[model samples]
Target: MSHIQKLLFIIALLSSSVAFGQLTEDPEDRRDQGKDPFKTQTVDGQPLPFSQRLRFGGGINGFRFGNPFSLGVSPVVGYQATERLIVGIGGTYNYTHYKAPYYTPTTYNQFGVRGFAMYEFIPSILPNLYLHGEVENSSIQVKDDQTSRSNSVGVTAPLVGLTYSQPISRRFGVNLTALYNLNYNDPQGVSQYIYGSPLVIRLSFF
Candidate 1:
């Protein structure tokens, strides 16, 4: 071959070899084409891995100088639409009875209902910890049977919280959470709104 033709042939061969080396060195190039990053396949069809969870719990608060105590019940249900996002509904019921001096004994009952969507800042299983928040609408009703007086108030309560959960087994775990409540309404005539302090609790369940 002529000198110029030989030089051209060598350059073409080197260029092809470099491209071949690149194809072998990059592992991701062999992945399936036309694959969607946000979609996955399931037994039924192309569906996301969605999960549903239900939790119910009860707690009591006793007054320091009173015999009458408060009883509470809360039930929460959540659906995980993605690895780091959850949508949920929770409801709470509370009842307390007390007696005032020179007055008939009375009872006060509070009922709350909330629905929320939350996102996890850190999504992992091991030593699980995340920043969680929820916005909820709640209603409070105060009824006095003796006086035949009834009061009903509706407000929005936003909760900003942090939760950490540790797994003990496949069906059992423990979690601790701290939460703050935000109130949306101002007090009106003969109606007062009060906020309690934040709450911290440790929970264990199956």
Candidate 2:
């Protein structure tokens, strides 16, 4: 008789817990369960507001002590394509000076336009790390020290690498990017606006 009473008590407690869970469960939470959080930013089955989807950010690159010194600013506008993806375009301008050992050096102005897409696909490597890819076209005037030939040419350089972002606020952060230029050794060659090597590293505020 006591065993039968204990079983009935256990069944009653289990039924009450289930009823309480159903009474307190959020409809929105239940709807979002098992759904991808990184899907396109949307709410209530519609797109997010315009102000939430469009954003502006930029970065600057400058170094004064080197064989080739470059100082420039890039201003960019981006659209949030998804929760983890951003696409943008930027304008680049840098004042560059190349000092050759045997030739006279002059300050040359370099201008560039760039398009970029960055995706935060891996959170395991580092939090807020992104894979960045860019294509930049920069125009510069060059003179060969060997032949003294001078010409102005535009070079299209493709860069692929990773960026580590440390967020300071909801809107701004510091970004450290390490990139390798795929076209650095191509016939078009590297740009005078870039830092000296095929390995390009940048510390910028965004």
Q: Candidate 2's residue-wise lDDT over 1-206, tens digit each?
A: 69999999999999999765654333234235764332233333444544555657777765566766677777877777876777788887766676778335655566789998878987656658889999989886665545666777777889999988786643356888888888877575545345456776767665
RMSD of each candidate relative to the true structure: 14.1, 13.1
Candidate 2 CA-lDDT value: 0.68
The numbered model that scores best in lDDT is 2
Model 1, 8-68: lDDT tens per residue? Answer: 9999999999765643342222234543222122322334333213233323221223534
TM-score of each: 0.53, 0.67
List ranges where model 2 is wrong by over 4 Å: 1-46, 62-66, 100-103, 143-150, 188-194
Candidate 2 Cα RMSD (Å) = 13.1
- What clash pairs does model 2 have? none
lDDT of each: 0.50, 0.68
